[model samples]
Target: MVFFGKKSPITGKQNARKTTGLKAASTRSIINKYHQLNKRKLQLQGLKKRMKKAEEQAKEAEIDAEITQIDSEMEKLGGLEVYQKASLKGQDQTRGGDSSHVLLKWLKNEGNELALEEGQEKKLLEVGCLSVSNAVSKSTEFDTIDRIDLRSNDPLIKQQDFLKRPLPKSDQEKYHVISLSLVLNFVPVTADRGKMLQLTTKFLHPQGLLFFVLPKACVENSRYLDGELFDSIMASLGYEKLEETTTDKLIYQLWRCRQEKAKYQKFTKNEVRSGSTRNNFCITL
Candidate 1:
């Protein structure tokens, strides 16, 4: 069954914002506000220069609108009064938080080395990691990963060969955990999706958890149809449906029960006979 959780609220009260005497606070807030205004003004100037150099008139207009919005927001907060005062008093101002980083941080905390026992040669693979390399690099758990990046352009692992490479065919019984996020949907382009699933079973030790973030059609409109197809592929390839929550009709987070390779051999053979989509991104990109 799919379930959805409400969005978490921001917690600003716990932040280290400055609290000073009424007179001092007023002065600091005004100073801080002005400093921010000045910084934004400089950024706008820089953006205008870039826009002129690129002759991107439409982009320049969009940027102008954004700067105007920022100005309006600043005015609503207190014009330059709040920032100017804060700067003069060296007081810190509070801003609202981003939930993605917060959620990642909490997940890292839960899965850190201190939270899990140390082991030799911890295997970790992240496909379609994109710009989150820093986050993965800093993870207490991924720290232990013998980092195997599948989609890397670096001349290390043969591109897309990881899917075809022989995995621990009968060893779907020993790893502690497996994680896939915003990645599975990309498989139809670079590798055989069914082969990837079989490889997953081969790599995962028995009892290992399969954690994945399902594609959101709203966010990944191009990949939405493929994402649904992949979910069906997962079930056929031996993943037992476990907990899955719908963030919305278009987005879902899921956990699947693990399965072994020998059990799905017949299904895999049938998949091989029917040929599949491959190397679409390589051609498009």
Candidate 2:
């Protein structure tokens, strides 16, 4: 004899729940790609150390090929979330308030010294401006401000990589002010940071001001720079420090370009040995 069983009333609801679970799992897998890429990078670093210890050229060559493959894969995956986390953490710790507030305060206190023409339209360029909420954009002191970033999709922000592309020749030395807030520390290499600074110098007028904000740890722990070393490097780049303020978390400085001809020079042991004529200068390293 054949028997017939009743259909479960919750069959449709069970199917819907399965569909939702699959979608959530897919989304999580995409996010986990970044974490996986980071792990692979660390593994590559270990391989490099092993390659150094290897006495055979063939073994070292094999490791090098492996590293190249991993790096290419990582590049295809795009920017990692770990870098974004570090940048956001540094931004949160910045003490003098938001970028807009600090800029406004500086203008209120030091605008007269700038000798800017009354009612003239001032130009400002803000690099690594992840959003349009910059001080120059918010304040009435400037008529034109360009905010550039790589990750933002907002139409107001220029979606371009500052390091990879060159600014228009016509824009060179056209800005009256340039602001760099928590941008330098993201550069993985010291040479790259110097390159960024050189690019910044091109965008400012001869007497224009640079408003720089950086994490305090950059000066304290970075292999490339400290407070005094940074100041010397700026001097070599023709920037004269006009004002500086510091907090436990961040350092803010206003520097005026002394000459248009000054170029970026990397700090070196020989340069230190030459002795800095600038007063109150000392290199801890």
Candidate 3:
């Protein structure tokens, strides 16, 4: 945690360093501030170290200097309370009786090899996976995922080339499962939704499964294609809806897609004929 004096707002020139006076704080004061900030930073970093090491050390010494440094840093970076409140509000929004966690738990526990395929040890694919955030692994027994693919760039997944890469063919001749969580709702790219599904399905064997989480939310003015319209799309592509559960809101649902009676078949249509319809957002905040 390094601290610097304010820079020139217009010229964007960095202030020159000085040994003393207004050009810089006193040596004694600067040293004291850095020492205090460094100590707190080290302490916070240590907390993330092995729990054993943290337990061995006594609590950080209560120091007015350290508190003052922290306050200064907070002020320079924007008040801590602002981010705290925003984060808290986001948590509240996700906690409002969503079945995502419950469904994830069920899939993790009961899904097993059936979800993957016969003779397969364990392999999973996440389609339209976003930044590894809100992943189902947290709400279920699954921890590590084999692979994840996202259409958008995120801090954790900045490489866009990964999306265009072709999936390696699997050796198994049985079913394989690919999980799509809250991703199919944003498939607005023209003529790519079905192609993307087919592209992924080609990686699986005969009885592979495609698990999807569809949002019923308003996309009246949306530029992307979503799952609500995918019902006909999936059916046309030989993918059958196994289970679907709608929450109190029509804009969200948990659904599963598997191949029809005869497996390994691809969709015949390349063009979507339905005119785009605009839906109203009914959810009252």
Against the hidden reference, what TM-scores do the models get? 0.40, 0.63, 0.45
Model 1 scores a TM of 0.40
Relative to the true structure, how large is the alpha-carbon lDDT of every model? 0.42, 0.58, 0.42
Better of 1 and 2 by TM-score: 2
lDDT of the structure predicted as candidate 3: 0.42
Q: What's the true lDDT of residue 270 in model 1?
A: 16
Worst 10 residues of 3 by lDDT: 2-11
Those runs of model 3 whose alpha carbons end farther than 4 Å from true positions after fitting are: 1-119, 131-135, 138-144, 149-163, 172-175, 218-229, 248-285
Write candidate 3's Cα lDDT for 59-111 as tens digits: 33323334454655534433323222222232233434333354454455443
lDDT (10s digit) by residue, model 2, range 92-111:
32323465557667766754
Global lDDT for candidate 1? Answer: 0.42
Please report how far candidate 2 places residue 157 from its true position, in Å. 1.5
RMSD of 3: 19.2
Error of 2 at 18 (Å): 22
